[model samples]
Target chain A: MKVRRSERLVDMTQYLLEHPHTLIPLPFFAKRYNSAKSSISEDLGIIKRTFSLRNRGILETIPGAAGGVRFIPEISETQARVIVNELCERLSEKNRLLPGGYVYLSDLLGEPELLRKVGQIIAAKYKDQKIDAVMTVATKGVPIAQAVSYQLNVPFVIVRRDSKITEGSTVSVNYVSGSSQRIEKMELSKRSLKKGSRVLVVDDFMKGGGTVNGMKGLIEEFEAELVGITVFAESNFSGCRVIDEYHSLLCVEEVDVQTKTISVIPGTYFNK
Target chain B: MKVRRSERLVDMTQYLLEHPHTLIPLPFFAKRYNSAKSSISEDLGIIKRTFSLRNRGILETIPGAAGGVRFIPEISETQARVIVNELCERLSEKNRLLPGGYVYLSDLLGEPELLRKVGQIIAAKYKDQKIDAVMTVATKGVPIAQAVSYQLNVPFVIVRRDSKITEGSTVSVNYVSGSSQRIEKMELSKRSLKKGSRVLVVDDFMKGGGTVNGMKGLIEEFEAELVGITVFAESNFSGCRVIDEYHSLLCVEEVDVQTKTISVIPGTYFNK
Candidate 1:
């Protein structure tokens, strides 16, 4: 396990990136790398400065017997805006407009790199808030929630439209479906979230915000507090939204089915 | 943003980590960091050495007009075994056993740190293959697939038990449920995957391997090739497996519902 300082720096950087928001005692790294405490501290200092200059994240160093270093993944507003604008351009493509005004977003969401950027942007927005877990509905929302949760370094809970035997006992709630305008039931395992936990809700796309609202109700049933709501894209043509407070990366103003035209703009993320 | 060599190294490391399996021309980094090509090359050398020593991944330097550096995320066999062993210990907890022999694994799969490790291990297994996308079932498998796809820098497609309007046209396939011994239908959006793709199938848990087989059939329907199959854990008690070729991180040897006991061991990953 003996390694040089240069090698140590590389390993430490990877380690810190993987364990964001978790405090790592200097002694642990020192022991792991078979290095002196002073050397470990120097390596961390280099990492912290690099992370800060690039706005990659914050590396806080604590000075105490029980203290260590922590990596907080964050994205600068300028960088986030640039990313959102690019996303807006991609989303405005006429081919994205599908039947019934639904947009073809699976391609964008499926790309890991895009998801990572989106996750970083959303996670940076809520970095200052205390979040216990991330919540999202099944299928489409899973990747979005997973990305945000990865950046926040918290467990994500998946709420499903149907109950599965493997989930054991689940708490189900009925809410009005946004597009369908029909009562729909969503369920979450009782063990997924603990009582009094603070949860952040994320999704791939939002139209009437009914699905997000349903997740909000599920949070209450779990006796948890909603920290915030974020979505990759929201549709302005949905008329009225059930929820008012939320953050979005892109906003779709119009989708003309006959003309095969679509208009997209940076979402609330830039407004702030 | 003019940065020092130390700062450049940190940023370069982060960039390479985020963009794995993709070549970045040295000039790009030189321009981005406002540094000379020679300086960037030296920085990449340091990163390459560090990554190799730590077995973090491969930092390949491709020489030519179009070549630069490519980061291939990898984990050594020794490291993979240790991680799988630790996972086996966690999976052996008696409390994880749920009703009808189901295991409560939502927590482990939800943790970003753990998922990153699992993803690295599984991705390392298929690093040499031509994998265009990672495929998985909806709900539990999304995170695992996302993690692996993140490492491979590829998109992931989810096969869902139920179809949503947002997914547009989908292709459906029927398979026998391993646990319930009942036939079930799974669907994937027709546009989610492209024909002639080499897809790596992944799942959170496998019992009879029915779902994985169904995914295999679905892959054939799309005219895509199956690179391999990997799962987080498989139950040893499952009488017979439908699929014989696969890799698993951990194996649940015994889950005594009456006695409230569970036994887990390292899976085929170590055997290979």
Candidate 2:
């Protein structure tokens, strides 16, 4: 359809935001908007500059016959720190402390805005990596994985604690639960991942790192590579983590059950 | 940040996209951009007109001392039909037919772009309603709920088939599994939702409507009102649906296991 330059700019901005990490040829926009290639190029130039100045994302322009523009969603370090600190403060509230020294994160994780910000922060860290898919355990981890996957523009695979008929054939792995130190099984659908795929593992909480390790084992069973591991929060109280080399947005320094208090700090992201 | 009008427009577009169905005062944008309220108003005018003309969403201008702009994400009927038609084509693939007459929808649901479209279509239907939260059964329905919640800018609660310690103090309810016709229990955390909320129930698939009905019951137990029910797809072959007054994007006309074929058509959305 025919469109004005101002309208084209707005449409292009929306289009780029929706299709992050995917290359869009200028001709595609030129044809869609019934505009000239030169005009579309100018529109993208404005979008690219605005995205960078606002720290919204990156718009990379390629110069070649087979080249196009790509949008890479990113969050600045200042913005990331602000978001994490706010979360830490919220988490430190006495009401967030649950039994067995657990901090209630369901309410925070349930919010789409918070999830999106968390996803952007996590995805920004791995933007340079070739992540084929995101992996996380079911229930609590689904939203985290979904958010990160959305930013990275990749599908997320969920590892379930129990087998379901709906999932068809699944590959199961056994590992010790981080907090309880009890043996647990995790399963993933056989068709969820292709062999030799690179996956980034994420979770809502990491205590002993046992669940993350279990997910690592599942990735191996699928013949996939574990690019990296990250979690929304890592407990300072858990004994001896089972895995190393990971990233976390927030660290639970203390959860005082008697006093009904919790202490949180910015995680490894800020330590760097 | 002392941004130019062009930069302000781009940043504003990105902000509106992220914070849909929410209001932002003019002074807030003016202060952020280091610009005058009049300039911010002009920028919003450009954005509002572009959004409506391109069918991106609705930019409502609330005027008064406490008034500002609210972005309500919307999908035009024509665009919604096109999106649903594309999904129908994808769902009709023979390979999607799984054991026991199930159509594999993980791939489609896993796609962020497709999920965004589906979410917009579903959210558009309930945009006028007082939806406090989006509710769905765990596992398959998480992504659908997440997408819809993203559009509505609200939190989503997941109902689990099996209990977990992570979700403390859950409210469990027994309902017959639609496909198996066997009694089963689903649980939702007591703290997941607030009482007297208006919830919109969503799922990836529906057959006999037993699961949706169960969720409706769960909503009542929480003292929340059921605003509406929506599914990605519903089975036409199911015997006697348990609930009425629901919306679906697609209908599964046939899932022939012996022939390994599946036929899908536009659902209630198109019927209207």
Measured over the true interface residues after superposition, the C-alpha RMSD of each candidate is 1.3, 1.3
Candidate 2 segments exceeding 4 Å error: none
Q: Tens digits of per-residue lDDT for model 2 on A48-107?
A: 888887788899999898889999999999999899999999999887776777778888
Name the TM-score of candidate 1.
Answer: 0.95
Docking class of 1: medium
Candidate 1 reaches a DockQ of 0.74
Off by over 4 Å in 1: A1-3, A34-39, A237-239, B1-3, B178-181
What's the TM-score of chain B for every model shown?
0.97, 0.97
- Please compute DockQ, using alpha carbons, for every candidate against the native two-chain complex: 0.74, 0.71
lDDT of 1 by residue, A18-131 (tens): 888898999999898898999888888899888887789999888899999999999898898899889989998877777888898888878999999989999998888899
- Against the true structure, whose DockQ is highest? 1
Candidate 2 chain A, run of 10 with poorest lDDT = A95-104
For model 2, name the residue pairs that clash: none
Task: Give the Cα lDDT of each candidate.
Answer: 0.89, 0.89
